[model samples]
Target: MPAGKGEKQPYFHCKKLNSMMKNPKPYFLLCAALIVVSFPTWSLSKTATHLDLVKLKNGTVLEGHIVSQTARSLNLENVGGMISILRESIDRVITAEPGESAMFLGAQLLERKKFARAEFFLKIAAEYPAWRTESNASLQKLNTIKEQLEEQRREKEKSDIEKLIRRKGVEAGISELERRHSAEDDYWGSVRGRLHLLMARERLDHYDLKMAEQHLTLAEKYGVTKEQWESVRNEIVAMRRKSLLYGEDKLASRAFQSRKRPDKTAAGGGLLALAGEAKKKGEKVPPLEWLELVDRYAGENDVDPLLIWALIDTESSWRSQVVSPKGAQGLMQLMPLTAKDLEVDNPFDPEENIRGGIRYLRFLLKMFKDTDTALAAYYVGPGRVERYNGIPPAGREYVQKVRTREAALNKRFGLSPQGRTLSKS
Candidate 1:
């Protein structure tokens, strides 16, 4: 401490050396503390910026920043540069920021063509200002996809309705189409025009020239082609001339003669005259009392009214009161137990009997899904039909009789076979 300025320090520095040697434990402790504190910091610095984790289907995990995405792929940035991955191959993704996660997930789903799900995520992402622009663009794409899907669905429904028309006949098919028209807004004009055209054809087939012309006019108004209109018009004219020459005068004479007496003939004769008179007055014929009830109920149930009429004519000749040896009665020849099952109090009552019989026929038709099989079931009993896997041999004559009468009635009344026959063959 008292050494002169010119004197050099001690060469050995023995006191300092002796103090260091005695405090070697302190130096070791300080070094240990520094290492422990710095290890966690280094680890945190390496992992803290790795905010996202992507797990691939191939069992590889990637820690990176999601950069961008397209409909089919995703781009990620990491220490090893940028990498692309297919959205379909990614097993899962994890992110700390919810908004950013939604934005990225939305892009991935969009690439996968999951438009609805993508739209949901993009809407959430749109709430974040940083992702708003890209999110909105994705939403626009989703809107376009939605429109395409809706258009496809509408086209499929239209095709299905058209097929129904082919299978169910014009009136029933047009009714179904109209119901759909009321419920939908797209392609309504086209549907209406198609319905009108079908109705025109049905009317023409039935020789209702005036009604056919009215429907054709409506079809034209609704955008039917001129060629179609002209063709249908020509057909109607030809049919009308043929009907007037060969059918109408004879039908009128028969109807007038039949109506001259009610007691000698079935009530149907008078009812036919009333229908003719209503047609002359341009009025719809009211529902007839007995025989015509078959038509009304069969039409409502989508069964062929002609078939019902043929059955009634064969069973009771339109008499309302006829009993078989087996205890079958009424116009439909319903057994008492069957009438009670159908909740009919009077089997002799025409309306009740027709209703019960048609309801049973509807059930059979549904069960068989074929008119021939259903008629067979009605004739021979469903159990026998099922046992034989077809019409029983004993029931074949009955079926032939019904079919023959049905054909005769169709020819006599000028009714079309469009929706009435299950099989053309």
Candidate 2:
């Protein structure tokens, strides 16, 4: 006979039971004893197989499967379907199979596209062969998806960089590239080297020779070709020599213009011309009286005297009574407001002016922590440098000029260890 739905079939066949009918009394007694002994064991085994134990702080106990848990709550599957219990209300959960619990959680995370976390639990689940094959397949798929997403991100980044270069020009583009290079996990050294070389050329175009040299050095470090390096090196040397000659001529011309009286003009012009000639003959000119004052203040402020000399040379050409068209005065070209802030009563006084300027320069150096940026802030304004994220376009030449003059003065005085300019442009 066929068994009905939800009915338990008898263990013995009807024909075998008919054979036992001859000894019906003994068979009935045996059947009753078997039921008495096996029922409790069957019930115990069934309860152990299907349920997890949950104990609560309120002295309540529950038997159910744990569906999921978070920091604040737990989802449980019970005979009542599903129930959410606040973690604060629960004391402990005793699951039947830890491996099965991990496998369930991993599957949930996989569905949510949390690939990294999913892989972690899935790897643990893989210790059980029942979950190993599915977990492995999911891990492979997760890796593939991650790779595709990364490739798409890189393509978008490259496209954006091209647009930036075209729209904002090389300096802005290089700034963006540097920011991205620092943040990216897989940085492209070749691309960075090419961008650095482009920036070096731009600096050269602006006559920022020291900055160009630094960029070229970085380019070589990042993998510029040797032939390209040599060509750039030759260009830098030629440009530097031309720049030095031009600077000397400009200084002499400015000195000639500073003297208004005819008698003093000839003497001043002659002295300036003699200085130029002496420089050409590789002879050192006598130091200005103001140099001693600058050294004293710079030392007192722990600032570089050569840097002050460069600033003075660029600002007023070492003229104590000179004033700029912009109303900056004295040897250090202190503006009226800045002079007041520095407590300088007379901007015409060389000692007071140099002291105020050196104090300000030291402040800028400490604030920016880079020589080029500090000079840029001094030349334009700190606000402008902050706005531009570096030296402003208008001030690049000024920064380069000051750094170039500083290098020269340092070399002449043997103040720098390497006898080379240290520009952080």
lDDT of 1 by residue, 323-386 (tens): 9876788888887755764557898988999998887777677666788877777666665676
**Cα lDDT over the full model 1:** 0.65
TM-score per model over all chains: 0.33, 0.33
Candidate 1 residues lying further than 4 Å off, grouped into runs, are 1-287, 418-425
Q: Write the per-residue lDDT of candidate 2 for residues 188-273, one digit (tens) a residue.
A: 31334544566576557656665776667666756667787767766765555444446535644564565332121222233334
Clash count in backbone of candidate 2: 0
| Alpha-carbon lDDT of model 2 | 0.65
The clash count for each model shown is 1, 0
Query: lDDT, candidate 1, residue 401?
Result: 87
Predictions in order: lDDT: 0.65, 0.65
